[model samples]
Target: MSFSRIKRACAVALFCLTLSATQINAQQKRTKGCLTECQPRIGIVSAFGGEAEVLLAETINKQEYVINGNLYTTGILRGNHVVIVLTGISIENATMVTQLTIDHFNIHHLLLSGIAGGVNPDYKVGDVLIPRRWAQPLEVYWSANSNVPAPCGTPRDLSCLGLKLSRFTSQPNSDYQIPTPNGPVGTGLFMRDTFVRNNSNFPNGEFKFDYAADPEMYAVAQTIAPKLDRCGPKNPSLCVAVQPRIRRGGRGISGPAFLANPDYRRYVFKTIRAVSVDMETTAFAHVAYANEIPFIAFRSLSDLAGGDDFTDVSALFASGLAESNSSRVTLGFLEAWSQKYPE
Candidate 1:
């Protein structure tokens, strides 16, 4: 062959080889259910449309991935790589999507931001809370009969069940003793379940309930709390009468039911000592705990959870304010976290 022809042939061969290798690597990533470069990134989740919209607005260099009809966006938020997703509006959806995200991405930290019902009397609408721990109030084994006698030496109070109906009862010894600065405080109506799973950090067994948020993330949130804007200027009509504030170090509870009764709200507050109630946080917390990932949540109060006479006002007016406040805090948290742990 002529020298010029030989050189051209060699260049063509090299191009074909590079193209084949690139195609093979792309195929492999798809088959394994991962991105080509699964960079260690923070995972951000929201359960409401408003919450997700707010976060998506701040995302830059966005890339979309559609898996099983669920949309996930990866981008830079607050100068950190993050994968943002919406978990829909229930515990089942939250658990499924959170697990899916962890399975497909190299999630270094998880942060959930959403609106919640105010469970504590001290928290007003639009206030944001970052609870140190989250629990599922609906995971209960109810007693078979209403006639079951209360434990001896204990008061015959149905309020301990944390439900309005007196017929429902929890096991006598199901209370969880949570350690506090003051002392050990007993809360909840069911003992935490121990699950044996290979993928979990605790292979032998570990409690699935009362999942605690990462202390470092909680500390970062506390630092950003004062800097956040608590009052709504965009929607002044929906602004809370009292100036909203960021509250840290409280218990957050989740259940399937939307609590709209005064009795139930009071019961949850008194029994669980919870500041916020939502439908999704506990499931997200559980999955994060099982995967041994550092996780935190910022929940803004949309309503009193049945404390106010205008029950419909929350969904009609206060949701936007709550979402706005939570999104603001979430952005602040992300900025602080990225600065503390720069790439």
Candidate 2:
């Protein structure tokens, strides 16, 4: 071939290579954008003490850490996944850490893990309670007399409120349900946070809680869901859904948190119906769900709420077992999630 002809051929090949490079660069830019904007970032929230510490320590990359008063340790677990721990058990404190994690880390998925108490009679010591809805406490006040109304607001019949009632019920405990096209739905699996110990330990050695409503973690989910999913991928955008169960490995014992209840007997059952009676999971669930970050809780039943009148504190420390159960469930859930979201 002539030298001029050869030069022309070389020019054509160069042009094709340039075009290919440009296309590849464009695709890389798009992928990075998705990671920053589209892909769901996950997080975990749990209290410092009790079963939460154990479960968190084992699953998370052990690098002992603390936030505020809450102690936590985090690191890579499964491939690209990362886990975070909250410092303490208070709803306000846990919520604070959760918010910080989402904002600072750009995390989109959040999970609440820990142990909780059983309220339903059907739930055994080892049985779990996946909170379906968080119940909100009615504004109440003492009546000067029986006929007169109480101080806060009159207790209006809330059952007719429909979805609102469900929302309220979930708000207190921090366990939330999303209102989807197909009615309200909870997270697929029951993540245990509360536990029971013995067969005979509640009312008349048979466990029971009074029916009175209050607040817990679902309140956080209700408060934050709108804030998180405002702009993201997943078409309809993701919302928070929580289901907290129990780990029964714990000895039947109640903590000071439960003991602090003014009318423990009357309100315990009522509070369970309205909110997450167990402490830790709701905090994690609420923060992740409300912020539009994806999260799922996996807790274990560690304590029976009724044994020894729920007075023993040491028995409630089934931290090791709780962590073990959470690890198994979380890994399984994540594996399934990867199949659905094969990014």
Candidate 3:
């Protein structure tokens, strides 16, 4: 064969190989995006009793669960790909289980479902607050001149660390909106891993529910998000932080066996933004968002946050059950989201 003919044939082979490689790379990129932004196996982290628990039994499918030493399972509502966990109100415990559920079950899309106390007076027990905005620790300091360790463990992969730092720094306001059925919901930074009760500062020896007396959700998110986001090079972590938009009210608050305590009211309102406070949702949201997993949370109002009245305790307790009724309406929002992206 002539040299010219052989050279022409070699060029044709190289062109074909290039085209095939381009096609494969494109397909891989598409698959990764789908995996990142798809419907997640929904999980609810909540206290063991009250309207949140009752609704779980009523609406979700039943299955026994043993999560991080806790044993309880109310349901497994699939198709929507939901898994509910009753974590009993500790920030550390809730964060661990959330990570466990996400890692073991491959639940990318999560919902931190349950109720919370309301700081906003306009909200009453039965009113719901869906977070559409979010705020992370924006002013964290990394000792200015000293050699700092990687933000995550395993030392800094300068390439990845540089990318992450760039992304966070570029967005001065790292806060994002919570996706919702009606529209976008407001989101905010919640203090977590802290007690919820009245401090001695508020008008009635209670916390004003701000930075001073942080809520558990904020701490939970901080702990859970970085861990999850560090899992892989491709992980996109995002959490949907939510607070129940009313004063303290729920079955646990109202039962005949219940006793009203002023300290509980004053301290709880002083710590968290919303009035009434619950155990689970905020932590779950932090984990979800921090890991770049899409999430949403909204709870029905259960009580009025301020004022003085022990006899009025009965009214406060009764109001918590309102979550049961409102759950029916909000469940649709989650349902529609699942239909669009069945995970």
Once model 2 is optimally superposed onto the true structure by TM-score, how far is the C-alpha of residue 50 displaced, in angstroms?
6.6
In model 1, the number of clashes is 0
State the lDDT of candidate 3 residue by residue for 1-343, as single tens digits: 8999999999898999999999998886444323222333555555435645554655555666565575545344524555566555655555677766665454545555454444444554444444433222221223222233244553322233332321222232222233458964423321212122222233333211122112322222222211111111222131112222222221111111111333434432332232434445545555554445666554554444444522323333443334343454335545555455555
Candidate 3 positional error at 64, Å: 2.4
Question: Cα miss at 73, model 2 (Å)?
Answer: 4.8
The TM-score between candidate 3 and the true structure equals 0.45
Q: Model 2 has how many clashing residue pairs?
A: 59
Candidate 1 vs 2: which has more TM-score? 1
Identify the superior model by TM-score, candidate 1 or candidate 3: 1
- Ranked by lDDT, the better of candidates 1 and 3 is 1
Model 1 stretches with alpha carbons more than 4 Å out: 1-37, 145-203, 226-234, 311-319
lDDT of 2 at 301: 46
Q: For model 3, what is the C-alpha lDDT against the true structure?
A: 0.41
- Using alpha carbons, what is the TM-score of model 1? 0.74
- Between prediction 2 and prediction 3, the one with superior TM-score is 2
The number of clashing residue pairs in each candidate reads 0, 59, 56
Candidate 3 segments whose C-alpha is farther than 4 A from its true place? 1-40, 58-61, 72-79, 134-280, 309-313, 316-323
